[model samples]
Target chain A: MFGKGRFVGIISSIIAVVVAILVGMVFALISGGNIIDTFKAIYMGSFGTQMGLASTINNAVPLIFTGLAVALPFRAGLFNIGGAGQMYMGAIGAVLIGLYVNLPSVIEIPLAVALGALFGMMWGILPGYLKAKFGVHEVINTIMMNYISIYFVRYLVSNGPLNGVMGTARTVVIHKSAFFPILWNYPIKPVSISIVVAVILCAFYYWLLESTKIGFEIKAVGYNPKAAEYSGISVNKNIITAMALGGIAAGLAGACFTLGEMHFVSNDFPVEMAFTGIAVSLLGRNNPYGVIPAAFLFAALQASNLQLQLFAHVPKDVVNIIQGVVIMFVALDRLITYLLTRRKGGAKGIGNT
Target chain B: MEILNTTLLNQTIVAATPLILASLGGLYSERTGVVNIGLEGMMLAGAFFAVWGDYITGSPWVGVLFAVGIGMGLGLIHAVLTVTFKSDHIISGTAINIFSLGLTGYLLLVLFHTHGSTREPVTQLPYINFTALERIPVVGKFINEVFFNHTPIAYIALGLVILTWFLIYKTPLGLHMRAVGEYPEAADNMGINVNRIKYFGVIMSGALAGMAGAQLSIGVLTQFVQGMSSGRGFIALAAMIFGKWKPFGAMWASLLFGFGTALASNLQGTNVAIPNQFFLMVPFILTMVVLAGIVGKSIPPAADGKPYEKENK
Candidate 1:
């Protein structure tokens, strides 16, 4: 079902890679660092050793879920910027359940996780509903929802019944039963149980997009809602479904942060993961599978940024520069295709913007 | 009662200055079809740059110009991505925001060696004096302090609302801009350069939004701090929607929000004894209430997010 556009897409990808590397070089020079040393530090930071690689992958866990959250909606031609908000809500949900409910390990774990997904689903569904029913833009609503989600968490932890007994804007530590099993006990090895969950999510997402009717309908609606409606597909329903599923993905990301990394709900927990997921999804070309590598690449950059700072005196702001370039590249895909097609003197470009 | 009334009126106008300027900025972009969600980022950058410029130059006027210039530069980046390359507008806008946060934070760390930078005894913009007219009594005190006591830019913001209203409804360029936003292909076929119009709209949006930031740092707060723009840009977006995309109407919408903000802040020391956080939440809660109530009927430009492409079929 994939289009012939993949060929041009791959070629443009190569061009993007070259352009990005060059941009990196230019940035390195501007920052008074040698290009060679920066690349070396980046390598050591991400995958020079087994421990490094694991840390990189560990960081990728949330990115995968968050990326899918965004990419799934894009498939339905919806922009779900509320992933940050949804993800935070999910974290709050899971943390609340994990902290309060005392149940068997298996039961509590799954239940807490489910709460996260449910929270995210609810958050995602609102914007989807607004778009489907009222034609209010999901982009604007989701963005707004993120603020609400963030503040709601603050309010809950600061003054609500859910506030930690210590009077801080954080929840009580989740029960041992609620914790995701850590992969290792080593101090330097930061990898956790969330990686396994993230991988499972990746598989589920692949199946959802490629092997399901809902997924097919989502793509159809995204490509052309009018035609899909004409052809008996309920475009509104599919759009809502896509947004809900996206929310679930984001919710899972939030749960991973709480259950795997923090083990408690704190105000500083999300740490821009929701926003980073948008960048990861965009960089990954909106492919569910592509999110894995894209997330790792970004997470590794984030993970290794401190080391880069130590090695080259190249500040961590350079990572922001790199990410900014990557986003610009991905967003400029249609432009890239146009450039490539023009270079070949073709009668047409690969397709949509 | 008269004294209290005059004081209340003064507070309202003082509170409305930033909102008025920023909302006008929103009007400029959204009316022309490119949703300027990055107005907050642009404003934040402007605030930071204005502080940086003023700190180094010791002239607030130079700082204001510096802010306007920086705002335009940021707008140019948005225009290139959204208008020319046809990137996802929300994503691109979010990137600008993230970038502004990180870039300014990083720059502050590097230059000031601090997270938030405030000048020592920062020089605030000089308030325009109408003291000579104050002898006219209760009405004169109200008029002088409330209306005429603001910085020069506040007056400029009032002018901007009127100017923007005219531009959107009267001028040929404004007509073309609205046409491009409402129906780009139709506008394109009519020989209007949709991309050019979008570029202009975004650039102009940035300039005014930047001025809003300048007002915050130079006029009101007298210093720049990280995340200082806070949610003001989004608040302006809410105002733009509440106003139903008319410039003068947006000014009124902004004033309503500004009134809520002033009320929340003013009640801090009084016996009403509400929590400060509640005060902070007032504008945002009002925004949500406004958006939930009004967004359904507010129609954005027809071709708002759809990046125009030349003939392909």
Candidate 2:
């Protein structure tokens, strides 16, 4: 991975990020913001202070899981846009157990998280199974699954069974035993151990995909399902496993967010993060290790949402605009690469541009 | 106590109008080989711009025109990315969605002082009331209520479905589009300009989807709500699949899903022992079953969603 190719990737990534920032600046200027002050405010909000930095790390924890959810599936050439649905299922499973069960924290927390992963795994298997059996496309199937899971969650929360004491849209707070252990940081919001879990899972993912036989078969199927099948690898099995693993990661994201931060599941579960995970996966090149920094970049940008509103007078939505622009350019990076190589007179890559 | 009534059917037609238009949009693009999941985003942009256009010109028709322009512009971006750059169709569609989501919100804040809902102009599109037919016997009132009382876009949706059917099955241009979607190399060998047809299909899809947005904003609700298209775009795609990608089949499927939506909202608080969300899930669940080939095989065009490139040799 350490070569001229890696250097080129780093350079292009910088270029993409820079262009995205410029686009954001343009939006700020359009919204009647002073350029330098907005830049300073964004800096001050995201990385300038210890408190802000802690908040950024906390924000990144969920993104790390969601990003891995998307990245994990891309390893098997599957597009898992169902992260939002998977996350909701995770939250539901965790909240259901956390709200109903009584146990020691050591037992309850992990149990709830595991249930969340199981729920997400069930959701993931639907699309994977459909795609493998009927040759139906996963993209549309995953999207349908998202709506189904989302509406089911809505039913459970709003007056179906899980409504809180006040009978509002949210559930009652989970038992304290279900809470993730909080890691004390530099004041403000305490960062949860979820970040450690996210990092550990990423490492585990690296080993699972790179050093394991099952991982090799999964990747081989993604590279070419026909070839993998001819070589005695079960393409269908790998596809379903890849999707289920993604579901587990997304479930962890939702469970962690609920247990460590929000403490209850609600309608406003940051569904957009699922789409942002796509951008992260692209930036990370679908590599688990790369997801860490990519998630941080997005989370830090989102951290400046309030500062952008207060100082720049730009709406908080502008950060999403910036991220959207970033994803667009990143998606177009292949075109940029093609142009770069054409300048140096190189051959086209494996896939035609 | 009765759930099935003319009022419900009337509501079904009204709700299905947007789905019909958007699914027809999906039909055109997919028939020409481009999978346009960005219909959701495109519709949102159209909804916002329709309100903005009405605010600017004080005319709902002009608002619709604005929506068409925005939708086509977004469609052009999708075409360039998927067709020329050979980017992943799904990825490019996702980018377009994200881009439109932000752009509409950004512009809404810039144009209107608030977030979420826009300032709706009082003037909306007129409904074509067929009160003259009420002078007839028993069926007259039923016909007027269910068939003729909707805004003009409803009729346009119907007209375009027929038009799309004729164009796709009858016209030479549509033949070229179908060939490009099914076998681009073969089409190219037969001297058809494959990319040109695909661009037209995609742009037309955007135009129709934009009109769908106009229907939502100016016709149905009389204002633009943030993310108002919701998952209708994706639902429209499912409807298209249920209809076997034919314009007429898609139209009927839209009406069925639209009926589901209408029933879901109407029965939200009723003691029917079933949650409204379950009704809402029916269309999606049915599409999944159909895709699984339980009832019938729902096959797409051969080259659908794959980028086409002319030989450089």
List, in order, the clash count of every candidate structure: 0, 0
TM-score of 2: 0.96
Q: What is the lDDT of residue B119 in candidate 2?
A: 67
* lDDT of candidate 1 over B29-48, digit per residue (tens): 77667877888889998888
Give the top-scoring candidate (DockQ): 2
Report the lDDT of model 2 for residue B25: 92
Query: Whole-model Cα lDDT per candidate?
Result: 0.78, 0.84
Chain A of candidate 1: what's the TM-score? 0.91
Summarize candidate 2's per-residue lDDT along B119-152 as a digit string, tens digits. 6454689999989898899999999988987999
- In the predicted model 2, the residue pairs found to clash are none
Q: List the residue pairs that clash in candidate 1.
A: none
lDDT of 2 at B272: 87
